[model samples]
Target: MAQTVSFMAVGRFEVREQTAANAGVHMTSTSPHREPIRVGVVGLSASGGWAATAHVPALAGLDGYELRALSASSAESARAAGEKYAVPLAFASAEELARSEEVDLVVVTVKVPHHLELIRPALEAGKMVFSEWPLGADLAQAEELADLAHRRGVLTAVGLQARSAPPLRYLRDLVAEGYVGRVLSTSMLGSGWIGGATYDDNYAYVLDITSGATLLSIPFGHSVDALTMVLGEFRAVSALIENLRPEVTNITSGEVAAKSAEDQIAVTGVLESGAVAAMHFRGGTSRATAFHWEINGTEGDLVVKADRAQWWYGGTQLYGARGEEGALTELPVPARYQRSLKQWTERSADPACSVAHEYALLRDQITGGLAPDTHGVPDFRHAVRLHGLLDRIRGAARVGRKVTLTEQGS
Candidate 1:
């Protein structure tokens, strides 16, 4: 049997704590009329491509959700995703899926360059949306989306779910409970081997930015999201972006592939809580890698390793790892390639009932007019923040200066 731990439902956060007698007692029964959420998924490539992958699977396993529809750029792919993922609805066009009155929310899993096209329509339609990170290819688009969402009061969200992991949540709770006392500095070593050629010509807009999924968005972007989750938001940052591998080929196939996007990014910034967060992203390596971070406070220390970096909501454990620390201590996050496997199994649930957790909050926002505790879902505004940060990094490098930022959501 799985080990049970004490937990508290603080806002949307399921943080662990030792104080209260009634922690993790399943207070969900008290909140009714907050019925199951209806959901649609678009893009279905990589993470999206593997719609049957983690996202769908996680939603499928959760108690209150539905998987109403699946969308892809091509009719065949959309059909394939629906058939493979076991969704009743499938559409080739994003607009068709986004406009589903039956769908309370949509999950955008398309490429970074396609984010704007995929996002604006859903927001304008007055629907809640959740998309993969790096909200935009750059800041201007991100800002435009954020501004629009804020103006319309649309419920939007992003995929920085690492904040929901047990260990990280535990760490955050510990810090709040005085385990780490007053935090001083935090350093994250996020390294991996996403070094390969990209076949981005299929998507034209990103010629100036990047090619493969490994470099810019997945590795660096997710790292930033996770670090921010662990250390808090940014107070300006100085970044050094690098394209280490001028020529690289896909590991799966032995052929020359075009390379454009950044291979490495180093950033150091202050958290909104005034703690420091420093991180480095390096790509193109001989082997796979892991992530690790530490928080130093006035009291003791809180640390987490990649093996402990698992994201879950309900029963979904997307990607797992057991490290040198032993099975008990190490978490079993879904393996990277295995993401789509779980999503495929999620077909057993009603598509309309498989909405993600973020959308649950979003549905609440729309219907009940309540505020979300952590509205970090990948909406238009977050796109703006991410893009703005990217620009700051580029500008800092050009001027050889550090960019100072005010507190986030300020």
Candidate 2:
């Protein structure tokens, strides 16, 4: 027989079996389980936000991570957030949270501008850090952070969760196993979110290229990253970036703001695998404007597409067909590709499902010392590499000539 017992304290949900021994309770060992990784999330809010919607729920659903602490700009906000999320500790500053012995890992989800400030202290404290995409304001910042982590000897992870996606994982395997035969070329087209007509005040920062949160870095970067993951890295490339909508009216303020970020992105490159690649991501969304990426090979072709522009939000439909197969047939992503936690599937529209997968991979890496793989977790070095590629693309666009990526440090 099993008895139900609950505690109202810090680490309350941590389950332990106990047996009656005299007047005291003795913990009985039914099975051995590793303690959850204590995570401290900086910039987590009391009200609903990105970390709240995705990270919080994802962490809660997993057994390998404990939502330990939350940090906000002020002590009041931190306390409120802690209360709202039921987190044990709340700190008003990143340094405090980073230095706390209660936290085994520091997760930096703040904006790009504050990333360096929030993450640097955590790295200095020798605590593992997980920063969101666009790891820094630019490539140089990303490299600096990577170097810092290297010097500190602390592990780091990035929010390039698209790499952990199950669909892309299966797609890569299918191509490698000769389902797509010898890959010839690949192409992708998607919306940039701000590419359409109206604009929101909340998304105003994306219009500024300096913010590093523009269409190019988020959607285009993730999409291209997924593409290259299935295919291979780029060798030489030519890129063209243009800003058609120079001025946009904020829906909330009804005030026009200068949009400097490029809304139209066109890049053609050769993959290290000898396959040619072409990608064009436009701004804004429409009924017919869907995110589509196709891979053409000698034996057959494969297509990965989504109704919405974002890659991580919903599971993209994958289709493939060989010579005898009449039309493109649906290639279902196998159950093996799915997350161990089924709760993630319930929120298909949220990107946190894939984020959860990344978190799981990181947990394993931290607790079990698992090595990082192509389809598993990505670190700051990976972010630096992607930043270098984005920089090379920008350089190619600026020079109006093809640029080789050999010189970029790995």
TM-scores of the candidates in the order shown: 0.71, 0.89
Top lDDT: which candidate number?
Answer: 2
- Across 35-89, the per-residue lDDT of candidate 1 in tens digits comes to 5667888876423433455577567655456788878878888787787778888
Task: Predict model 1's lDDT versus the native.
Answer: 0.56
RMSD of each: 9.5, 10.1
Q: RMSD, model 1, all Cα superposed?
A: 9.5
Q: Write model 2 residue lDDT over 1-410, tens digit each, in one string.
A: 34443221112122222223221111211122377789999989987678887789778878878899989999999999999989999999999998898988788888787788889999988887889888998998999999998776566788878777777778889998998799999988898776555588657777788988877888888887787777878999999999898988878777888888888899999988899999998888757867888999999999988878776656678999998888998987777667575666556557678788778766655554333232336678778888888888989999999998884531
Clashes of each: 43, 3
* Consecutive 10-residue window with the lowest summed lDDT within model 1: 22-31
Where is model 1 more than 4 Å wrong at Cα? Answer: 1-35, 45-48, 196-216, 270-276, 285-289, 307-379, 408-410
Off by over 4 Å in 2: 1-33, 345-347, 369-375, 407-410
Which residue pairs in candidate 2 have backbone atoms (N, alpha carbon, C) closer than 3 angstroms, thus clashing? 195-283, 195-284, 196-284
Summed over model 1, clashes come to 43
